[model samples]
Target: MQGYKKETELLTKLLLEILPILKAQYNLEEYQSKDFRTGDIACMKSLLSRLKHLKTSKFFSTASSDEDLKLKLKVDAYEKTAKNDQKVIAILKNKEKGLEQRIRELEKANKEAVALKKSMERKDEKLREVMRYNTVLKAKLEC
Candidate 1:
């Protein structure tokens, strides 16, 4: 009986030491109630079983595998593609700016052409009036 009690005490001590570490590593929440006793063998056994399961599962392994490396390579490739796309967008924006400036220049030239055409039309009308007046005066002199 004494030996069994000693074993129980030792188990409790071990559990106290390991529990904090496991909780920190796995981001685990406290499973026991606030009023729960600290040295319950059942609780310690349950925790030990959980730890064993975690060790046997892939969740505990930190070593990078081939799959992880492949994923990293894919991420790098995608980043490169994103950079190239951004460059293309920047180039297109510059072209758009150039086109806008060209449009403005063409519009200004069109306005100037229209103004010149109107001025020429007015001058032609004045010339026709002068020719008609000259013809009338020549006709009066002949008479």
Candidate 2:
């Protein structure tokens, strides 16, 4: 009886671990396509088959209600994980948009700075020319 209990516990733990992995793998875009790896599918199928067998076995029958309760817990866990992931994705998307806007603002500021620099250079050249003309007129008057 103790051995059977241990076996059931181990099986439940394995199912819990495998559920998350399967969820993650299946959720991936690459795995959603027809080109998904056969090996992963085969492995998941076998694991599910074993889990089904364990669930239907007489050894686990006495605790069938416990198994059902655990299954419910698993479902709840998966749902919570999915919701948290969505929240994180939304936050990251907002952050990305903010960064993009910052980049555009920085680019516009850079362009304005460049134009201002050119304007200043032109003003400096004009001032130098005026000084040269004033010097030439003064020399002519002295002559």
Which residue runs of candidate 2 sit more than 4 Å off their true CA positions? 1-64
List residue ranges in candidate 1 displaced over 4 A.
1-63
Q: Residue by residue across 15-131, what tens digits does model 1's lDDT show?
A: 554444445455556545321245566766677677667656564454265345335445545676789899999999999999999999999999999999999999999999999
lDDT tens digits, residue span 1-143, model 2: 89965665564555555455445533422222222222244444556565466566553454546556456546656787899999999999999999999999999999999999999999999999999999999999999
Which RMSD does model 2 reach against the true structure? 11.1
Per candidate, the number of residue pairs that clash is: 0, 0
Error of 1 at 77 (Å): 1.5
Per-candidate Cα lDDT values, in order, are 0.67, 0.64
How much is 72 displaced in model 1, in angstroms? 1.7
